[model samples]
Target: MRLIKVDHIINFKLLGHGDDPLDTKKCHIDLNALRAREDAAIRRAEIEAERIGAGVTTEAQSIFDALSKTLPVRWESTVIVVLNEVRVSSPYKPENVVGGAGAANERVKKVLELERKRMQHGRQ
Candidate 1:
């Protein structure tokens, strides 16, 4: 079995490298999207910090290797690194709401209509 080094990826999704129809490469590789996924990985690592010490592992990777490793899970809560930044979901009402999802131009609505017709044989 050989592992191919992939570089091209898009939208947090991996596209595959070979002509084979059943390729695991497509589903497994998400290198370009890792930055967006870093927050979740960090949060997961934080939660599992204790496991690093008492974990049962005979063949442990290097310190740097483990540090660079990303968690296979995602985080729900948004973790902000900058100070003086309030959370957007804070319902307590803030002094100012600037440059946020709510403040942005969000006008994406859906149009719905009925496809049914022929009401009682053309309303006879």
Candidate 2:
């Protein structure tokens, strides 16, 4: 929860709210309310933080240690996954020099693998 500050003022008929006039004692009351409100707000935020810290991370997959849980069992298997392979040939290769296109393919393969991992993590 977020707290927002609000400014309040009294409207005197003679002043007509055009020329500003404020009472300090009235402000003191508002300030006291604001202080106690702030203290209560802080306590609420700390409680929320404690709740978050207490939340259990149940069986999370490390980016390294395989997010693929649930037993990759037999042919029947415990988990199901679909892998994809795509091949695209760009007509324009940069510089068009020797081995440039082959180098590009190697780069594309790495990018594709990275994209796959990213998509999987996003699902998680």
Models 1 onward score TM values of 0.16, 0.26
lDDT of each: 0.31, 0.36
Question: In candidate 2, what are the lDDT values of residues 8-75, reduced to their tens digit?
Answer: 44442464555344866545456888899999999999855532312222211121113123212111
Runs of candidate 1 exceeding 4 Å displacement = 1-32, 50-124
For candidate 1, write residues 1-124 as lDDT tens digits. 8655566433365687668866787567677688769988998988766334233222222221222242121111421111123222111112222233442212100000010122224446
Q: Which ten residues in a row have the lowest lDDT in candidate 2?
A: 73-82
Clashes of 1: 0
Model 1 CA lDDT for position 104 = 29
- Lowest summed lDDT across 10 adjacent residues in model 1 is found at 107-116
